[model samples]
Target chain A: MRVLVAEDDRSSRMVTRRLLERLGHEVAVAEDGEEAWLQITSGEVFDVIISDWLMPRLDGHRLCQRIRRRENDHAVSYTYLILLTAMTDREHMLAGFEAGTDDFLSKPVDEAELVARLRVGERIMKLEQSLEAQVGELRTANEKLHADLQAAAMVQDSILPRNLPRDKRVSFGWEYLPCEQLAGDILNVIPINPDLYGVYLLDVSGHGVAAALKSVMISRVLSNDPLGSLLLGETPEESVTSPSRVLALLNERYPIDENSSDVSFFTIVYGLLDARKGTFRYANAGHPPVMVLRNGATELGKVGGPAIGMIDNWKFDEEEIQLDDSTRVYIYSDGIIENPNEEGEQFGYDRLAELIAGLGMCSTSRGATVVAGEARAWNPTEEIDDDVSVLVFGGDE
Target chain B: MSKSYPAIDQERLSAVSGGDREFEKELMEAFLEDAQLRVSQITEALQRQDTEALRSAAHTLKGAARNVGAAAIANVVMKIEEAASENELPGSDLLGEMTGEIARLVDQVRSSGT
Candidate 1:
């Protein structure tokens, strides 16, 4: 190890230098406290500083203090400060520790003792250097992991519907909020035929990465021919006309597993709206009830059976409602009602029903505006926990 | 004439040693060499207008001096380093006094040949 020897006397400096050299240590000589300080601060690395207590222009105690202060001064290694002191008083020793002296060498210094102290200083310096290097590597790894997670989130978001179709007959609006990097809610508005439309809202059992992956799987399955037909309960002849059977078939096909004990099931409300027939036929598998507003009156559509995937061979009942010129239907997942406020109260179903009723009393065109307003009012200051989906359909004038 | 020894001021030596020859020699050596190096660096740092370097150099020198029993030199270096670090130089007379003390110590050591 390279050591710095700070002594004011020529003979003493020489003798100390000889001692350190004999121990196979590199020694740098400083005539006084001030010079030793400069040598150490000059971007030079010194493992230990063997300094005198008394010197011209900066004595040993002050020198040790200065060296301690410089320990964190640069990007280089650590420096151990050893104070050579003649004063062995308890109070003085305390003062030396306060000044940041790592160790003390009593005057006149013992050769063996000095060597042993240097060895300790050298070992500590090596340990500190290794620790610092490890910390830097860990920081780099953390940054890379964060970047990868961000990239995955972007890909997940890209799989969602970009924009719902805009037509005079139907008004579509939706909101998606993820509690983490990914969300479990998935909504899609796909045109099954020229005059037929398929609209569904699905909420996976949980939030975050696992739920998001399941949502993507459901999306893929729904997009396929056989699974799509099965999920929609499409028959060879009546498949295009009825959406209720599609949901029933989905429940029958993929029953919820009871023995596995995993909280991984989804609730969905899917409907097939016929523009020419002025009718909406839907299948509800234990999802939030849909709302039908007509002539300033609101009614909640009943769910036909238990939620999809909850039980095998669950019969899904179908509900058909003829929408008059002044009628509108609203469908949503449970997230909006489940939103909690700072008061710990959920934006319950009652509030949602009231908001729908109030909007029906007002006008059909203001349906979207009223629903959003009510949700905000329910939890004005809190963040929404899940996704919100609202679809409004108006009949021909 | 064992190595033509300088007339040892027994009283002064004993005063510094506390009845230890090795302690006296170590104290004298640490004081002279540490003081001179620190003072020289301080002078150079001041000439270069490097406030940080000047302060640090002076501070280390001060601590080292105080450690081995040179309180007077430590006090001077502490003041210099602090002033330089704060961008304030002490008066020329004070600096001269410190340098003069350093010279006297060096001369005393050289003549004594301890």
Candidate 2:
């Protein structure tokens, strides 16, 4: 090992240098702390430093602190510091530790104990190097995972309905919030013709890259033709346009593959709204009930059925409600209703429907805010823990 | 010559020198020069009644002597440093004994070729 010996007395410095050189270490002698600091800063890395506590220009404690600061900034390896002093009091020892001295030795140093202390320092430095390498590896892997998730989120966003089925017969308002970088919900507004419209919302079981990927796959297949898996028509231009037929076809094709335990199922609500004839046809696959706000009353209805991909050969039901020009239709996921506050009380169905009914005929964005804002108001400290999606389709005048 | 101060073990110095007579000679010569300068400073401080300078010179001499395996000289210097630190002067007889021992050690190392 390369060692540095700093002492004011010429004879003592000579003795220490000779002893260390005899112990198989190359020794550098410094007259005082200032000279030793100059050698340390000259880019020569010494493995061990044996310095007298009392010296001119700078003290051993101060030198140890400066070395520690350099180590923290440069970060290659640790330099062992051994403070040599004649003062041997408990208070002095404690002060040495606070100043960052690694070890201590008395004046007229013992050659045997000095070598033994150096060996201990070598072992500690080896362990530190190993730990630093492991931390570096983990940081790199975490950054890669974060980048991959961000890219997947972008791909998922591109597949959503670019513009809600636009027409003078009705207006649409909607909002979607994902708890993380990715979400599990998929909704679309497909136009079958000038008079017919198809609206549906589906939610996968979990949130993340895997669940978002599943939703994207379903979005690509949701087309208004015989070629598409969702809302398939018997002919190229003529769609079946019936809520039950669309869901039944979906159930028959995408039943849970029992051998694959990793497969995820979903709950959904599908509907066909005919603005020209003033009729709504819809089916529910174990999703939340669709709300119909007419006149002064709020009506809740559900065409009950098991969530799709859960059970094989399960039948879905369709329900149609007579909606006037003043009436509004709301389709949403369970995230809103199931949101819990600090008191553990859910923002249940009654409160949600009542709040929306009071919102009247505002834009979908405005109404969605009121409901989302109410959830936040219930608890400031506890944020919502799940994804929320709301689609309001109404205003046929 | 009568051996008055033998607290310094010759075997310890030989072991530290690793049986190298030339290195042992160099160490003794360096220690002798350092001791001569410190002894003068201590005697001057005593003549001027400067307790701080007396204590400091004695402390340096004591540490330097012990480093070169001169334990007997180191112990005497230690007593002088302690006395000066307490604002008391060491006995004239003790001071005479310490200077005489340092002179004898230097003369023997100078005359005896390693």
Expressed as tens digits, the lDDT of each residue in A1-397 for candidate 1 is: 8889898766456556766776788989999999987887787778788887878899888887776666556455567788877668999889888988878887655567777888788788788778878888998987886676566566667766787666566555555544444567777776766666777778777666667677777766554255544433345664463566666666666666677655678888887777667777888877888888778677889755677777776667778878667787877777678877779888887787777766663443356556755666667665566665555666633
For residues A94-139, could you state the per-residue lDDT of candidate 2 as single tens digits?
9898888888988777678767887876676677667778878988
Query: lDDT of all the models against the reference?
Result: 0.69, 0.79
CA lDDT of A366 in candidate 1?
Answer: 58
In angstroms, the error of model 1 at A370 is: 5.0
TM-score of each: 0.60, 0.82
Cα lDDT of candidate 2 equals 0.79
Best by lDDT: 2
Candidate 2 backbone collisions, by pair: none
